[model samples]
Target: MREPADVAVVGTGVVGLAVAVELLHRGLDVTVVGPRTGAHQGQGTRAAGAMLSTFSELEPQHDAVRAGMETAERLAAHQAYPAWLERIEAMGGGTVQAPSGTWVLAPAGRRSCLDPIAAAARAAGHSVEEHDASSIPALRAPASSAGALWLPTESRVDSAALMEALSRAVEQQPRATWISQSATAVSAGTVACTEGETVRAREVVLAAGCGIPALLPECGRPLGVPPILAGRGVSARLAAPGVEVEQVVRTPNAEFACGAHLVPRTDGTLYLGGTNRLTLDADPAQAPSLDEVAVLASDAAALLDPRLGAASLLDTRTGLRPYTLDHLPLIGRTGDPSVLVATATYRCGVLLAPRLAQLVADEITAPGSLDAHPYRALRPMPAPRIDDVLADGAAQGLLEHLLQGGGHLPPAQQDEFAAFTALALRALLDEGSQAGAAVRRLWERAPVIEAVPALFALARRLEGVR
Candidate 1:
């Protein structure tokens, strides 16, 4: 068993690698343990679609959407693609794209997806345009009815090149060691790898993506938080005739349906993705489904220019995404001081990496400034588990009615509506509700009809009832 270093980061994927670099930069001795050999070396990083549109992915009212946007801005300005690009250029890792904008297509049928989101974005004071599909040459090339939302400041990075650069960056640091080993468990203040090498550390961070809970069971409920689930994302890259797309393109639908993203690089190869499937099976070798590739390719052809039609399929890949029940990421230290669990950024891992790394690093290095209250290992309220989602749905429906036309219901129905509304509000206000903040966030975006208790409350507050 090797003595512990200052920090032992399990899993050398983008998240782990980023944390390793950050810790080393802060003058800490760090050991990155992972199967960074054979077929697994850099698999997660290689499979990423690497879009840096922090605020564009979700409903704008989401705390993470706002936080992600701010985080992306800070990382782009201080520590992401630019720094990565410089390092890649030095390493001669071919070419990379540093585009400053992201383009999203909103098909007419799916326009409802953006109404509330656009309203939310407006609340955040961001300029959002609903451009008809014809507005974009590549999008128009596909003959779709959707318009586009252009976020001019967002960017994309060549993930593979970026990962290689990170490897180089870590090598440059004298105190950093990228050890080839799989971490099996975390005990007390030490991490024991599968190969029996133990590294002691003042701080141990489990950034192993979907493999997290399996590596360290304590992390699953660290201080009573919910367990992390694995969200599988499959993607394929195509060799194209250098389609000139100024920004990343995504179609918003109930599901990603015809949703496809086209990320172009100077190398004439574009990375298209991705099918997000939730599963407990964590196999990296699972090839992209032929059906998925065909669909993705078809969607890309519809959304991209003629050049993409002539492109050949180069390769397909898959990786596991750590998803929490609530979409927000799990960052900061656990109630257990020595073990810090930083996983579950979902699909936004790349977008959230730099900020998350810095946040974790800051907490570990300068503990006084960060208030772990919000991200406390022991959540002040019980987290909403997967089973609770069903109940939350019913409560959501009741609350909507009361907020809207509950007063319009007949007197007999009004009392029932009032009862339903009260129950709903009580559950919503309860921190233990599985829906967590999603119910409130959604309500803020779209008003609901008043049904039960809300109707009663309104009738009582107002002069007269029916």
Candidate 2:
């Protein structure tokens, strides 16, 4: 066995690096292993928007997986920015400029979608201000709508500066060793490097972003992994020609645009994003999809001032965000206590890093300080139904619906239908559960009338399957 360190953290994204800094702050010997430092290129924090607004993201749509998100724990991460940013700057690291305010907009006279969002913010003690359309910024054409709800507390930080600062902090630590090598495998406390070296420690922290499931099999735990789905988000940086907005301006659920989001950087570049597609098996080395870029640009032009059409383009970037079937982030220890996990925060990874690092660090060094129920690592992951793929945290709800007669066909054959449904669905999940895209693909390949009876017969004839 190689020499064991106090702690070995895998992955060098913001979360992993933050954990290293926290552990070192507490006087624990630490080693951070991942590509950016030496391994290869673990892309995550670098491509993040680093928005620190849980209040802005308080859509009750995901209440099933991540309940109590508005509670103190989630806010702790976003709240740590003020103090943490100061600490980073004190170490000679550059600053992350967090502009004040964010505008959540809706189409003309269609503010109904925002009612629940506004109500949730008030219930969580956050402030929301409504603005009249006449006084709002003159966004050129289609994108310009009546007015918006001003989320004064929801702010965004420059992610590039934050990551540079974090990298500096991690490097400055005397007890933290920076290892640059792709971790090919991990078992117990030992991580097998692609460079033919095995590094071991007493405990390990896996913060490998979307690469979590890949390393889980190597960890010697056979309790199955949450088949993580990767959503590729693309962003374009541009200079708004005539736009006169000081705060981050965003739209709620723009179908034409991915997330229908736009942000004006401190450096005068309007950051327009983001196109999300399921990149389950796609290679990240490929360039950002041009189709996605075109749609985003088109959407921005329509949603904002027509002058956006004349804006200067700076650069385009892409990052694969790790998403789970339930949409809830995994943050606690895994089935094997030796290997703790923190991945699947999705778009909120950058915002949640600081507080999540503190919580995970405390869990390792000082256990029981934070409740693990909300972030339990090894709970049974629910499969997305064919109709509602990617449970969106209503796994239990879907199960209860099936059991409570939500969509049973005929009463005469209800029991057989339910049993057959249960058996066939279980078989489809044999290899591993998948996200919605696969089911959609299957439907496209075969006619529903023919495919239905075919799959049913196949399920019924399977040997030794109860």
Candidate 3:
């Protein structure tokens, strides 16, 4: 180990970068180590709508109401969202923008779907207006759709630009340094890098997404971190012709995959995304299937505009969001004393970074300065059973795939599987396409998987003969 600084942040995604910048600005010596796309680029932070939609991400009021002010806490979090975005923009010199409000739609027949959301938003005192899908030409609400609600205050961030801007801004800080390397192991104040460098720091922040739980054991204090899983998502970017979309649009229900949403970049490119499936390998070299891209594109085109389907395919990107057992972010120190946990913000990482960083930095400089966040590393939430997870939609295909050759699978189902296999799973939609690859790598890499007995039962149900 050489030149141990005051702080070492072992990740460069939005959360890690934000924490590093915050600490540096707080007058602490800081060193950041993570894989780099180039001399100054980051992974994981890419591939997102970068929407700072606080209310949009919340569960409906029905659940909140039933939980008895359980959501009051989330509303408090929402109140601080805008301020955090402003803080980040100030650091990046206005590189990120929440240019316009976000519009959410419920398929025509499902208008009722917007109720709980609207209720929650109204409870938060945010103005909400309900209207038919036709209200927004961009959403192209089908007759089947129930309608939608618009939250003009909800906004999107230029995720790619913000990421680049953060990297540059962080590197320019006199007290901060960005080291391009993969961390092999991390403890309270020491981080060992794959590049054969050992960094010693006064304290360390482990914000490496799914890698958090995996690395804790390697650091000799695995018991301090909770079980965290990874949700892999695929998104495709399209080049919009003529006037580019000026607003964000999304479906009310996403059924088996992540929700269907569209985000327009400042440069006029539109992003149609994304699909979520359980994956262990956060850095898989695999690419999204053309069929997967088409499904998202076609859905967006149907909702937003016909031009979307005809748009040029610019590129596709993938990101693995870290998920906790309770779906809340785990921030703050662990029993390991010096190890501060800041990953697991999941889909809200970019939008919530500024505030989260502030909380982490406050804790670091003055322990217990900020009250504890709802998510704690040592919480007693039990991990979910793998079988209960299997039946979850969009991922049902994964379970089906795991039980192959139960000759009980109808001839039609087998024929369908054969078709996709012949063309390399091209026809499988949602998680089906990614299921095979994920299963093959399960024990080798997947962070979460269901139990074996459930697998056998599913297989038995699928097979005519064992």
Q: Which candidate is the best by lDDT?
A: 3
Higher-ranked by TM-score: 1 or 2: 2
For model 2, residues 1-466, the per-residue Cα lDDT tens digits are 4458888899878888778877887889887787654322326566655656565565445353243653455567757878877776665565767776777766553466466557656776888888654445645434336566877777788777777788888788777777778787777888888888778888888888777767767432473456566667777788876786667776664221124566777777777775565554636565676777776676566555556777787887777777666666777676677788877776778778878788888889776554545666677665545434222322322232233211224544654555556455445645343423333344343322112332333433454343
| Candidate 3 lDDT by residue in tens digits, 1-466 | 3688998998888899888878877889999988656532114568777876656654332245433343454444456656655665666535555675777877533456677767777877778998877787544455555677888877777777777767777777778777788888887688888878888998889988877765666432454676666776778788867525577787653432445788888677887775666554455455776755666676666555556667788888777778766667888888876888888776778767876787889899988654455665666656544433432321334433343212135657755654443233222112343343343334223323322222223333445433
lDDT of 1: 0.61
Ranking by TM-score: 3, 2, 1
TM-score to native of every candidate shown: 0.73, 0.78, 0.79
lDDT score for residue 446 of model 3: 31
Model 3 segments beyond 4 Å from truth? 36-42, 60-62, 65-94, 218-221, 253-256, 302-307, 369-372, 385-466
lDDT computed for candidate 2: 0.64
Model 2 ranges with Cα > 4 A deviation: 37-42, 60-67, 70-72, 91-94, 108-110, 141-146, 218-224, 254-258, 368-371, 388-466
